[model samples]
Target: MKVAADHRSGNSFLDFLLSFVADCSKFQSGYVALIGKPNVGKSTLLNGIIGQKLSIVTAKPQTTRHRILGICSGPNYQMILYDTPGVITKQMHKLDELMMKSVRSATINSDCLLLIADICHPPEQVLGTLDEGAVNLIKSKPTLLVLNKKDKVKQSEIQKKQEWYEKNSGMDEVIPVSAKFGLGIEEVKQWLVSKLPLGPAYYPRDIVSEHQERFFVSEIFREKIFQLYREEIPYCSQVNVVRYVEREAPAKDFIEIEILVEKESQKAILLGKEGKALKTLATAARLDIEDFVDRKCYLEIKVKVKEDWRKNEELLEHFGYSGKIASASL
Candidate 1:
């Protein structure tokens, strides 16, 4: 079965012919869920497949707290990729539980599942990463066991691991990939296109995501926090864009953001000596935001204390953990 080629490529004569053929033949579109344990390159794979960084990535695990939607559109197909938070066996806080719910919701909605795993480590049963709730959900759908980070492992090891998963893991297919280097991504995409049902495009071809601009702005700040800070500080922190004002011309766009921490000490640490650390983070975030938005803007940041915010159900629900997220407004 032929699938959509990379959408980012130029429109050559051959490409145009292929596009015409795809239009006349069949068009496939559907949602794909990226699921795996922490730091297993699920986000990386999504970004690579979408050919854009829709989800925030860091060396730290659990950097992605929300289910980020990345839309990839070719002439014939549109794949809506859900980059979800990593699955954890232990729920340390209400936030973790909410994140798990988000994962399960993504699984329910997806047409197919990509279960990513780090290839450097020994292969574990796919069932081990999923909870009881997800096992049935995954089994009912077409699931692919993706062994990511293949570049870090030997060719021999890759074969061994692939064999191990194909034999032991109860998945429809197994494919080794390096999400960071874009290896074997096309094969993965083709597999998804084969699994996706035939349908019309769910969104316009040009748009990459339905999320508002402010949502990405907030995520940029959150990603920077995870990168700049160490230990509990990043985990305890939550970044929100309280206010965003777009200006016409001479005036730059104004964005007022706030960071929530659990304690005064954590707030102080975020503030740093003479508030230097916060300033540094703001500068880094603003640069990325400017690049992402393709314009310049004035950024204002404030740090606040929200005691036990992670454990607060009402607050977590408000944060879009349990319901639809109007990211800009929230």
Candidate 2:
């Protein structure tokens, strides 16, 4: 029994593939990278464009560690939207340095930059681009300044945000948007389409992302972990999807995922008394993945300790962090 990797055995395969690749083309559509400070709605913007919660969102800062590449496919185009980790403002650990490098690299690799700034933040707070002197780099790029959460503030106040942004950042093109409410998103789309050059598609038409199913499943679980433990355990943890099997005989699918923490204390924090927390996290994550895949997903979870993989270079590479496009490209 031979198998096919490129060819799908089911109907709608070719149509999906062609559509996926066709969407990535600039003659049709193109890619854009959203970069800005944490909690500024980058993930919200990506989800808003793709109309799905592909990237996890939370109120806590530094919620995103990896670059979420979400492809939005339309009739004649697609946008390979990348949601990167927010740029670190203060001096951070080695891991922080690598993540910030990834964000900066995304800024350069992208065709257009949508620098998000929350309208709800202080009027004097630095919004859009980071104030750490990376401002000029973004200013030189074909950029759009998105004032997200406009609905959270008064319309007149949002205009004040626009004026404040223009005076501070030299950003002439500031567009107010409410990502949660689906306002001003189409304008952002039109703005992005205008900036990208016409070219052949970069990916197949049917594909929504370059990552496989396991990556997304693990990410969805990670979101639950982050939401639950947050400063207690999230940044010090990672999700490893060990096994994913599609069963034709049983007409079912199962996934084995591992959650790694940095220490025994952290492990305790995750499991809780009689493993209640772990059970809760797994249940929520399992439901989310099941919905995403539209199947009954059997999830196996194990909690382990890796002791600071974030700072260890070899371990980071082993975990597939061989310079995510940010470090590799720039």
Candidate 3:
């Protein structure tokens, strides 16, 4: 993806200041959860901030289902960002309820909250007057309001939304950003570093996320489903990595994944006429998975019907939504 080049560069005075700050005793580290309604560019913002894509992105809403942790560490600070599922006002299924549970857990566990809103659309049209859960969380935490999609909106419009958030939401600060074009990202980093509490690094500086390789592999397939299919196909489907194995020397890694659907008709839709659609999806997903693992992969994909799996607690747990966000150092 195209992004802005780093503006911080070689200047004797700036270098001296950075070195001085790095050597200071006041270092900062903590978790900051990114919370907002669906399709508000939360995943895109996280990818831009962390300088990598840990969470999947699509035009479709509710693409992210779990709490994904993206770590950003500098010489004197480490900010662990949690990209959570969008907070839905109405829980339509057991899966929706589980996703909301993740939002609540991330909000409660984080040291600071980053609430994002799409500035290209009206607040009521994009975020829809804050939900009670969101309102309570904002009231309780040190929150930052982020106006995303600034590249698509005018400065006057952005300012209007910023003022509206300041008045209605309990946000401590407002920062306008364009996640796609990398506008105002430096300001966001500086603000986060200032707000973070003084503490040691929670994760190793080299690592970018906490999830396993298999988890990302499944997510890649799920993202392909979202990108290729339409209507209820993406919503009623889930990807599970049933088997994953690594090999040495002259051998390729092996991965077996199952695409679970709620009905037989959905399976047919995914498979497509003459299995052309499934082949296309598998090729795209395999390429991404290979790039992620840095190895050639032999992938096996199958479609299965698991009626009402979203509402089944057992199935949900098996799919890795354990009804609790795993504990992380804040």
Candidate 4:
């Protein structure tokens, strides 16, 4: 069954399951992609709307490296939200460029584009901040300019910021919200629903995301690396789920996983003295994963250095981000 709710027949178990399906106002379903420069709270907004931290959030720039999916289903419709990487220019590493391309691709056919702008300043304050390719996206699309971190700013400052966007942006609308405070999220949901075209729900009510449990596990670990190390580790990291086996020991039904990085030196830093740091990350991730999935997970994380995998086109393509990049660069 695409969505578990479809099987509901008022059977005791099914009846309870049906009520758990998410619902919004009666409206058409669609996709929304959150886009912006690094550290602008796009991922935070996704988590707020879904009421789950499906997308990792950190203060560090470029915390999100690729498109992370989060799905929300309300009684009337389902909306898929893509929390994408920050758009920035970098010629040294091809993966950086490809990351921006993923953001562009996610924007296409998106019913609502959440253009996250930090509320502390006006868009002009970020002049020359947007790369050519990234700026081109805002120039053409119907986007919702979300002034994130609204709670951190004064009301007068927010209006000033909105006025700046009105003069500068060609997007459909601009709204202020604080992703951290979970403020204005429901309104954002309603606005996005109104924008989406009327159509059948693409996914079932029970499905929360398109990725497997293993993928979420990898993300949790990656998030820890990003959160704990920030600038030191994020730029040099990549988390791969090498093995994910489901355990059905009744008392210990769980999953096992491994996290892969890019350099031996980096691995050394991640593993830490007596392998203590890795152990800490795994322990924290295991609990969060268990809570998110509602099942026990025996997460095993090993740090391995692949040596400049991000810089190699072949490796990047294999990991699914280098769709247009050539093979020779590897």
Per-prediction tally of clashes: 0, 9, 0, 6
Candidate 2's C-alpha runs over 4 A off are: 1-28, 124-133, 249-251, 323-330
Global lDDT scores for all candidate models: 0.88, 0.78, 0.84, 0.73
Candidate 3 stretches with Cα past 4 Å from truth are: 1-25, 124-134, 323-330
**Tens digit of per-residue lDDT, candidate 1, span 169-190:** 9899999999899999999999
RMSD of 1: 6.8
Q: Tell me the tens digit of each residue's lDDT in model 3 across 265-285.
A: 999999999999999999999
For lDDT, the strongest prediction is 1
> Once superposed on the true structure, which residue ranges of model 4 sit more than 4 Å away at CA?
1-27, 125-140, 249-256, 322-330
Which residue pairs come into collision in candidate 1? none
Better of 1 and 3 by TM-score: 1
lDDT of 2 by residue, 289-327 (tens): 989988887787788888876788666655655553211
In Å, residue 208's CA in model 1 sits off its true spot by 1.1
Colliding residue pairs in candidate 4: 22-73, 22-74, 23-74, 23-75, 24-74, 24-75
Worst 10 residues of 3 by lDDT: 1-10
Q: Tens digits of per-residue lDDT for model 4 on 171-220?
A: 67778899999988988888887778666688877877887766677677
* Model 3 quality (TM-score): 0.87
